[model samples]
Target: MVFARYLTPAAECGGLGLQCLGVGWQQVSRIQFDGRVIDCYGLMMIVRGTGWFVWGDLPRQRVPVQAPALFVVFPGVYHAYQPDAGGWSERWVLFNGPSAHTHEVLGTLDRDAPVMVLQGPLDGMERVFESLFEAADSSSPHRDVVTSSLVHRLLAELLAVKATTDVARVVRHFDEQATGPLSIGEHARRLGMDTPTLRREMFRATGTTPKDYILRTRLSMAQRLLLTTDRTVAEIARCVGYSDAAYFTRLFSRRVGQAPSHFRKVGRPRGRDG
Candidate 1:
């Protein structure tokens, strides 16, 4: 058990809005935990070996899993986890902070379903935790605030990566069609998915609808043309698959905040000040 503690000084007055109670790494060669409900929110990431997370009421299932995964212990949740006899290595953070509740609100952490299996290698996340620990250990003023900020940043990145596996194929297909002319339904068919399913999945992965994504791609092409070529707006519009120059210019002006001709002159989209 390699652990470091951060004890708040009484003279420091009220606590930092958020605080890291402890940070550590442990090689679990022989450890058995019956389970305990704790007050602080915890996030543990497995660096090696396999394990089982046993939790919940009624059904009480034991989820057999391996490394490169993270599990959270929401405050007041009864959770027990242990490594297989082969053993495991773990990195963890025990924190009590308002940001922890923000994690729950963002659906990044759930009290009922507390496990998230990482899709790939965790070297990047390992470094993040190390930096977080270092920040907490430093004696700099407002280091507590810094640690809390790092915690929220880590949670945001984790949520961004969650469920990214399913979108790999969609992303591949999207890249292939980066300059093509295809309707949302046609693009959906290219990926062997119905329009609605693709729409939902794309939105989940990218936070934009299929139609909006294609439009953005098209607009990017138009921006490139305006920057690099002497082509007329009508010619550039046709190259990006727009039939009418007027409609394309209107749409471009709406999204880019400048008339196409003006953008071509200014080398950038104009703002309200412009």
Candidate 2:
């Protein structure tokens, strides 16, 4: 049984200061990159089978079989692997270049820890990898442009999945209430539960209290307004649920580690802030 798929040579591409490398099931029995450095970042999708990942002395964690798992490895981190008896089959792309915003976007994950499991299938990754490989192997004048666009698409998918799993229910409520401010009491009412019960459930499901969840939700909105609009801090605060700008600033700084103004300067990229 082949555990790892070796990507075809045609799928390898180099340009835009980024080089894309991939392996399909036939490529090798196993693979490793950068020899477990602390700061290297990598995007890997398991195309088939079950496997385990061990990083930074953490116990080897089993990756669910048949479920697509996305892994982001940060620089200076040490990672090792052992495939299941069926062997872990996967597709991986490694690239570093000028427009390496993927690295920055991935930084959000890096701030907290080294391992994250994205909730999605690896079904579409093979095609994307194939296209990138072909573009790289071609001598066409538009090769870099085409490969860059594909890389962007791939990165977008990675970030999208990361965002989806990160916020969960809070994000659901935020989307439903995107048009205006949503009070915590009001949100609880909408969910058919009282404030206390809602708080309990939120904690049970997400490991965060309802109040903190709502605060983070609104703060996330406030962050967007700060970066993209000319809205005053007070207005943005009110838009998210805080009537007191000073209080909001305190809360934002507590959770985000920076004042709202500073966060605006830094911009909201995605993933956990602190």
Index of the highest-lDDT prediction: 1
Residue-wise C-alpha lDDT for candidate 1, range 1-274, written one tens digit per residue: 6756554523342244456666778788848799988888888888789988877675775676587777888777678888888998888887776666777776677665576667744555767788887886788887766776666666767776554633765766775685577778888766646787688778877798877777777788888899999999999999887989999999899888998899988888654312
> Which ranges in model 1 have alpha carbons more than 4 Å from their true place?
9-17, 120-123, 163-274
Cα-lDDT of candidate 1:
0.74
Q: Which segments of model 2 are wrong by more than 4 Å?
A: 1-18, 21-35, 38-40, 57-66, 101-111, 121-126, 139-142, 169-274
Per-residue lDDT over 222-247 for candidate 2, one digit per residue giving the tens place of the 0 to 100 score: 77788889999989888887788899
| Residue 47 miss distance in model 2 (angstroms) | 2.2
Q: What TM-score against the true fold does each predicted structure earn?
A: 0.57, 0.46
- Where is model 2 poorest over a 10-residue stretch in terms of lDDT? 2-11
The window of 10 residues in a row where model 1 has the poorest summed lDDT is 9-18
lDDT of each: 0.74, 0.59
